[model samples]
Target: MDNMKQLIKQFSALITLSLILTGCVSLPEPIYLTDEEVSIAAKVGITEQQYRVIKTSQLYQLSPRQTDQYLRILHEQEPDLRKRIGRIAEKNIGQPYELYLLGEAPFEPYDSQPLFELSKSDCVVFVEHTYAMGLTDNWGDFFKTLQHIRYNNGEVGVVTRNHFTEYDWNRNNNWLVEDISSIAGENTIKTYEQTINKERFFAKQFGINVPQDNVKTVETYVPNEHIPAVAQYLQTGDFVNLVRSTGKGAWVGHVGIIKVEDNGKVNVIHSASPAVRKEGLLEMAKSFLAETPERFAEGRTATVGFKVLRLHETANDNLKAKFDGNVPPIMMLNRKYEYLTKEQVKTKLALMREQAKKDLIENALEQSKQSDIK
Candidate 1:
């Protein structure tokens, strides 16, 4: 009996050891790039000009921590700015643009201001302050600030909402032309035209590449029930093949450049506002088709479109250098001097593993106790 008990104890120990070893081996090793690797990776398949644009762009060479900090700061300030504009607009119940311009109004339009005056150092900042806050009906005061800015200097860019229509054109065009003579008004039309022209000029000056004309429309070319393929493509970051669903049928949606990372994260950096975002490929398909899972399984179709855009890389060498040394490029770019080192990453991973093991053991013990009670 004593020998048997000792043998049982040894067996239990072996099982525990095996489970621990398996868990350790199953975890993926964190990959770190050397400075050289980072540079090389950035330059791969990109033109010299494109690379230069990327280097100068705000999105370049940002470390994860720096990105997080930038996002946090924006999130913090947005609410206050909105509140200030809201209060000012509320004070002036009914007022015309002229009233505000003549200092007869309490609110100032900030959206109409130049990019420099708006302090839009980052692309995300511009999107958040302009489109996200501008078009909302209740955000009139906040919008006034934007208008004031534009009226004082000049509109930076024009963002068309989800649709493109004559009404959309009329909004800014009448002002640009300074044609208040006609029903549509020449001034408004001219202002809109001027805004568009200025936007184009600035885009060229900054080397910002707008989306292709054909790519703007919805064109679907795939089967309705192809969720697996869509999910797979999204996971793999193959932006060239997107599934689109129109009212008529389902097809490949506009194929565009897609960048993906681990943790099921995906983002498309293009002409769209809110440049960086989390969009589920599957969710988009469902919404586009207006179909349930059952309908998709039953071959219900929808219309969608796909367009592919080539990306150019800039600061590839600099990015590579930082990564090669296990330094986070985003941190350097954002000037967040202190970032996680390889040692720190390894330590965190180990700590997480240890906690997981403890939890598992506790759960198993509880289960065993319940089984014995049964």
Candidate 2:
């Protein structure tokens, strides 16, 4: 019996070597849905064209119409909100990453970039879009919810956009998430204060003025040394802010979401330089910290800690109420409509830009005078 087993093993090794020498072995090809298969999967509201586009693409590649149908089906299959968020995020695991993907385009003509891009996303866009989709069941509601999360008071404009991470983003979306760093890492939590100067930032980045400077805010985070202990308390869909230190101070440099596996392993899902990816929490931290010496020697930033935010139990209900009257077929997307020639639109945009700069300068001057008087 032993001689027969050895012969079989030798024969299998010879066959493998022969195949390798002949170049007959290759990796398995990825399987994608066929056109007819996509047609079969298309629901009532999804068009054949839309279905075809998303047949081999991720969730981000789906059109608004297809999104509505997908969301309905998704909600039916996965009733748990946290799991839904994780699944929706996983669908875009390989989505290309791009910074500054959205702006108030045709709506305001201030930032001429399109309002939405389906192919790529940055860290903030990934998190915001994922949350928006998780909370709504239709495309129109998803758009409205996304707008609410992206801008202050749901106003779509350059100045209203959430620019300051701690000052604007955390404060504006407080209703959706709660800071749980203190509780989750109470034993090893650390706090840092940093000033966010949006006024100077806007002036330098966009050549646009602002009326006020965002004040300093205290942030609580769990230092890298304590991540292992704090990670257990983290649940799926929790927000993660990667904190980095500079000679000046510390700031929230990047962001992502948490997904705890059934096996009790914690992962951080984020969109970075190349694409959306998932990494074990400890593994990511180790990689970041391992490069600290080289990064500091090269005068580059290094991640020092993390701040986690717990999702609110009432997030969906609150957002639904806020978006009660803001869906398509009933909600008006554009503020006003007027047909204009291409040249006319260009002229109007130039005029609007100039007017916006003027208004910002005036507001800054008024605020300066008020500060002087005080």
Candidate 3:
């Protein structure tokens, strides 16, 4: 158990018996707690009522193994920011999109709150959580970091949340991420005006008031013709927002992070319809307007266009060193992707459950046990 974590080094060996729980060295089938299995949480400190809520709660779900690996990587691994971002994303691939946050979803067109969950997530939340983890290994720090990245002035709540990517995030979080559509690329840069009816959107969707002047109008995008010109300028870990032209109002249709291969091919990681997947950006560009007259152009099959944005920083030595334009498949995931065979998985899980039972009793017996960090 002493070998399980190195975070609270100040704590004596007394707490070691209470910790040392899990990991994904061989990504095992997640041990979903059945009613009886869930009851085990009581021995670990959580009450039965709390355990039920954990099972049913939308935002409370988190994979102990994945969360552990996330912090572990941040504490010790490649020091490059670009590679770190990719490394964080690999752990979340194929995680089913969780709909529990619809009531308070943050990536909608009009409004959302500064929510955080390391367990399950939708497309935008997927990117948001992954981005947050890239900043630090501590969960305590992850929340505040996410708030700053997701909202204006680092404030939380629906009103402060950045409902739109271009105006909200790109403009506000410039200190965190910069919009390179107009700056980067290998040729002449082209820009366009995008207007969003935020007043109407917020009013109708969230019963909130946004002045007409408050409606974002300074939306800039790299036109279709210039995508290729800017292709070379894109780097791995760069976030791309697929711009769409809906006659109703201005908005972004899809979003994902770019991954540049060693051979110079560019791909993106996103959770679209089926699941979170990494695919070629150019391949999707060819199909944007597949059946329409704009098919041959830069439009995606069901979308209108795209844009490029990279993490912002003045000192980018890590990116310069790591961003050789040759990214590995989802960062260096050789170890994270390791998997256990069925028999080994079962044996491991059984051992884990037995350990859980003993740890809980030891913790309960030691009434003065130190509180576990969240």
Leading candidate by lDDT? 2
lDDT tens per residue, model 3, 38-106? 444533445555554434432224454435433543445456777777766764566666542432344
TM-score versus the correct structure, for each prediction: 0.23, 0.73, 0.59
Task: For candidate 2, give the lDDT of residue 362.
Answer: 100
Which stretches in model 3 have alpha-carbon errors above 4 Å?
A: 1-69, 98-114, 183-190, 209-212, 246-250, 292-302, 313-374
Q: Kindly list the per-residue Cα lDDT of model 1 for residues 215-269, writing each as its tens digit.
A: 2222223332344344343422222334433233333323222445456544432
Give the candidates in order of TM-score, highest first.
2, 3, 1
| lDDT of prediction 2 | 0.78
Residue 324 shift from truth in candidate 2, angstroms = 11
User: In model 2, which residue pairs have backbone atoms overlapping below 3 Å?
Assistant: none
Ranking by lDDT: 2, 3, 1
Kindly provide the TM-score of model 1 when superposed on the true structure, using C-alpha atoms.
0.23
Error of 2 at 33 (Å): 12
Error of 2 at 53 (Å): 8.0
Tens digits of lDDT, candidate 2, 165-279: 7778888888688888876546878888886666555554455545463476889988777788889889999999998985347889899999999999999999998999999
Q: For this target, which candidate reaches the highest TM-score against the unseen true structure?
A: 2
